[model samples]
Target: MMPDRSDLSAIAALLREVAGSIVMPRFGHIGPADLRTKSGPLDPVTVADEAAERALTEGLRALFPDVAVIGEESVAADPALLGAVAGPAPVFVIDPIDGTQNYAAGLPLFGLMIALVEGNQTIAGLIHDPLRDDTMLATRGAGAFLLRGAAARAEFLPLRVAAPAPLAQMIASVSWQYMAADEKSRVLARLDAIGQTPNLRCAAATYRAMASGHMHATVSRRTLPWDHAAGTLIVEEAGGHVRRPDGEAWRPADIDGGLIAAADRDTWHRLRDALYG
Candidate 1:
């Protein structure tokens, strides 16, 4: 069954606790010894990421003993853990720190993301900003909301995507880091059609911006489940549009083929055509 408001609160509380204890404490204090390269120099995994993931995993298991937990750090050690997302049972996907590069550099732009996936579809999602102590959450069919302050005294504000705008007036976050050389060049050339294309290096923040109407869209060439699953659901719930570059719905099991999220379907189509057509 999908989580209700009470369950969402519990999960949010867990994220807050872990962020306060494990993530924020090490935000600007990371040392060379506390960090290590993952796929490459551009991909980093810090002590905070590992520690927070452990706490999150433990907390989630405690909350739902039967649900499988697939954390970025844990999956790095055991790639098979990712298979849980495609399984028949429910699974929780966690990204302890979404922008390790920024966090390691003392920039407070990272976030903690978690998504509950069942039957290969995301049923709920949460993105918590540790510094702001606010969370953007969404459960399928219930709409999206932003919760602030402690759980007991939390205030939930409804979230919505920006009103539709012309392609030339839209601002977007475009990630070209993993794109093929030829494809990257082609997309970059077409980006001039948009008003602005900034790279925040944090998917959580980008999704938040799009959901809250601060930005119009985002285009990502890499679609890792931990990175996009939660954010995509949040945006869609907030009345945005999301799909792979080919115009098919994005699923938790999709690892690549690019993804586009926009304020609406018309914007998505325009952006897709500008970038690929």
Candidate 2:
């Protein structure tokens, strides 16, 4: 069943609860033993990531007992868990902490991301900032909003992407870390055509900045569902455009082929042409 506004609020409260009880307490206290590498030295997972994932998994299951939960750390331990996104049942894709590298270093630039996907479509998405105690959320047909404060006394502000601009006048976050050397070289050579291109090393932050009109676009080489699913929906709901550089819609199960998110379809096309054309 599609979650209504009340259900969304409940989920937001759960996110806040997990952030307060499990995530924030362990933030700056992470030690050498509390951290370990995942895919490589650049990809690290900490105690907070694992603990928060467990708590969120349990909490989400309690809310919807039969729904599937696919978390980043959980999938790392068991690759088969990612198949649930393509299954018939709705699945919650969780990135307990999106910016693990920054979070492990005690930088307050990380976020908690969760997306509810039914088949190939994302129904609801949420990106929560543990340090700020606020959430950016979107339900399929409903518009995106910034949620703050307690559930009983929460505030919701509509979110919109920035107006489209010329390629040389836009600010974007371009992530080419996982790209092929040839493709990376081509992208790097073309970046001079844009106004500013910075990599936040955090998809949640990148998406948040774009949705809040602080950024114009973002190009990513990795398409992990937990990383892009929530942010994709949030950006699209906020009047932005998210798709593959080839101009295809982003599916929950798509793990490669690169993705581009921009303020509008025109901006997306322009950016794609400028960078990949």
Candidate 3:
């Protein structure tokens, strides 16, 4: 059964309102607020991120009791919880804050990304940019759209990628970490060899650029399902393709592998080959 657009719109609006209230109050507060380093010093999580995730989880669970939820902050506390939910049940995966670094730095480049995942497929998804008051949403066949206002009036916009361009002429979005030093050097060398400029904007904005035709492609060695699931559907719906560099299909279950996404089939294939070469 298809999810209702009105319900999704309502959820988006609710998320925007809640997140805006939480984030807006801390815009320029400089003092440290009980930061914790998860994987490393570079991977920091703040009280605001956790508070926001809690708000979303509670609201979703209250609003839709049947659906399961897997949030990044919750999984961070209990990594084993994800395996327990690995079944056919529809799970709502969420990254309460995609660009944690940006958020910590008080930059407005972060967002709240959520997706409804059943098995290996994403059914419905929304990425809400509270700073810009823009919500990018998509359901399986309902098409993608941008909702920007209090009334939540739908502005239908077909997502389309530009024609396949050469890797040299493309602006690639690649992350700096997640790969070994040698592997990172090799990837950077190849990117430089192709004359492609590498930009490491947070995943939300980076994928948003890919969907909006502002960037050609994005490759990541770190596969956080919560981060990729929502954006993956958005990019594919926008006429792009995402897969492992070896040409294998990607799923939310495999969150420890690599991904290669492009504006089109030609670009996807070419980038995959270049990355593996």
- Candidate 1: misplaced stretches above 4 Å? none
Clashing residue pairs in all predictions, respectively, total 0, 0, 0
Candidate ranking under TM-score, highest first, comes to 1, 2, 3
Rank list by lDDT:
1, 2, 3
Q: Would you list the clashing residue pairs of candidate 3? A: none
**Which tens-of-lDDT digit does each residue in 148-196 have in candidate 1?**
9885799889999999888888998999989999999999899889998
lDDT of 3 by residue, 95-118 (tens): 888888887887778888988888
Best by lDDT: 1
Winner by lDDT between candidate 3 and candidate 2: 2
Per-residue lDDT of model 2, residues 44-162, tens digit only? 99988998999999999999898888899999999999999887889999999999999989888999999999988899999999888999999998999999888679988999999
Candidate 1 yields a Cα-based lDDT of 0.93
CA displacement after TM-score superposition, residue 146 of candidate 2 (Å):
0.6
> What shift in Å separates residue 206 of candidate 2 from its native position after superposition?
0.8
Give candidate 2's TM-score. Answer: 0.98
